[model samples]
Target: MTGRFVLQNVKTINGIAVDIILENGKIIEIVPPGTGIGDKIIDYKQKVFVSSGWIDLHVHAFPELDPYGDDVDEIGYKTGVTTVIDAGSTGADQISDLVSSYKNSKTNVFAFLNISRIGLKRIDELSDTSWLDEKELKKAISQYGDFIVGLKARISKSVVGPNGIEPLKIARKFSADTGLPLMVHIGSGPPDIREVLNLLEQQDIITHYLNGKANNLFDEKGEPLPEFNKAIERGVHLDVGHGTASFSFPTAEVAKKRDIRFNTISTDIYRGNRLNGPVYSMANVLTKFLYLGYPLKEVIDAVTVNAAVWLRKPELGRISVGDIGNLTLFSIEDESTLLQDSEGEKRMAEKRVVVKGVVINGEFNEC
Candidate 1:
């Protein structure tokens, strides 16, 4: 029920204690601890931290695809993520089905329309040039409008096959025509990472930037490549997709040492990675960042404010009066936890971020 409720004595990431009053799915007031009153009072007593709901910028939410699909809520609010962006799990041919599938879901869902008409029905979606149907792609974007946030092109070796950099070139043109940003997945590449980075304009995202693949953004010395620096200067966004095969602890360590940071932290998560190694949940992925020596605020912001700002939905990034009551309640537990990256490297974290519950659509769901 979208009832009046008071989340009392909850702490912000900055450690400020406050009471949040939510009514009819909107935040009515944020007051001093113990001051706000409502019909339903759920007091955290300053033990829980609240922030704008977590937004996963990259996920596979089309449950039909075998290797790269999942139920929306399975990776969303159930795991402290109130919103998820399906990262091109479907394209023109199947985006409608993907959209229809999530209509009854509690989690807020969006998608990046794949340039290929077939999408991830097969991993090498971009291998066929015929699947890059501009007409159908345009039609899907026009039909979905805002529901389709941007375009996603997996411009790696396996996904692109012998087509090389051609798919990305078309994707760039599509981005220009549609006025949408591109979220490009990078991995082992014969198209060459430099060519991919060169094609991306300002605001295009490079997911899996820290992957330890030979064709990664960093050089052999763990220093950023000239093209990578150029891409950063062009305002290309870096994302930590952290898929089952992406994300390397050593690569991440190098990035941390060199001060290379992610604009958004996402799990290129599907059923395999979520239930197996590496990316288990949003909290699990955040914990790895914590182990990398990032502060709680920066790590949390990667999934919250940073993602929201990129999505052009600033209202989803902060808690304020008159905004929708979308938030995640979590805590830092001082317990030793073992974390593993995609490379099978392990690190022991002394502290972990744990999700307690989430407030979405004016209703609270305990994790």
Candidate 2:
């Protein structure tokens, strides 16, 4: 049966309170606190905040694939995130397996079909250009276009091997053919980042934008690089893919201080990072951004409306009448908290972002 619920006085990061009513997996109505009508309801009483359902754009949760991957629920509904897009965890050849498995999951799962046919079955999926079979790619995308929301290419020294920029260039051609928004993973670069950034047009996403490495957005003196700024000005989007080795606290802090904002905030959550150090969940990554000085509304927007806009999936993010009833109920707790980045640098913040409950497919679940 479709579950129904009413929540009142759910607090926000900005101290505003909202009341929501969810029915049949869509938001039926939104009214002021204590104004909604329903039974079997929980009067939150101004203790939590409600935002659109959270979307994790970059995660590796194809459990049967690799050790780097994790369970969907561990990084999805269990952590208050309603939607998770497995970033290049599978290629065209294996998407059917993933989609079939995820159909039974409670979390809303999506995928970014990797440029390489084998996906991340090996860390060096892009090492051989032979695996980037254009014919097979088009076939897979055509067959599973619904599940493959976008395409991904990891153009880094380790992943791309001797192919350098050739893999990305090939992926670009495939993106042009399929007309999917390409998500480029920037890491220690063998191919110059300037070339990579220049090739990206508007709507293309650069994940892991704040890596502390010299090859990333920050300059040697910690200033935002001119090339990076130009890329941003060209309407390219920046996403925080806080993976096991990607995020750097100092880099994020410097970017935040200069008002270099992210278009979307995503945790590249998986088994290793989720259970070990660095990224524990999507909330943990969002809290790190909070520590980096992003305002409450901005943080909410990044995961909600902003992400939906970038993904071109208007139905996924937002709380409004007739929209998918995906809502994240959370709180801003004032307390001392210690947060760490991938680099092991630590900082203390007085406020933490906490999850109370989430409204998913019109059903309420505790976080």
For model 1, state the Cα shift of residue 295 in Å. Answer: 1.1
Candidate 1 residue-wise lDDT, 182-231, digit = tens: 99999997988999888888899999988998999888888898899989
TM per candidate comes to 0.99, 0.96
Q: Candidate 2, 274: how far from true, in Å?
A: 0.8
Could you give candidate 2's per-residue lDDT for residues 144-208 as a string of tens digits?
Answer: 88788889999899999888899988988988998998999998878888878878878899999
The deviation in Å at residue 48 for candidate 1 is 0.9
Q: In candidate 1, residue 36 scores what lDDT?
A: 97
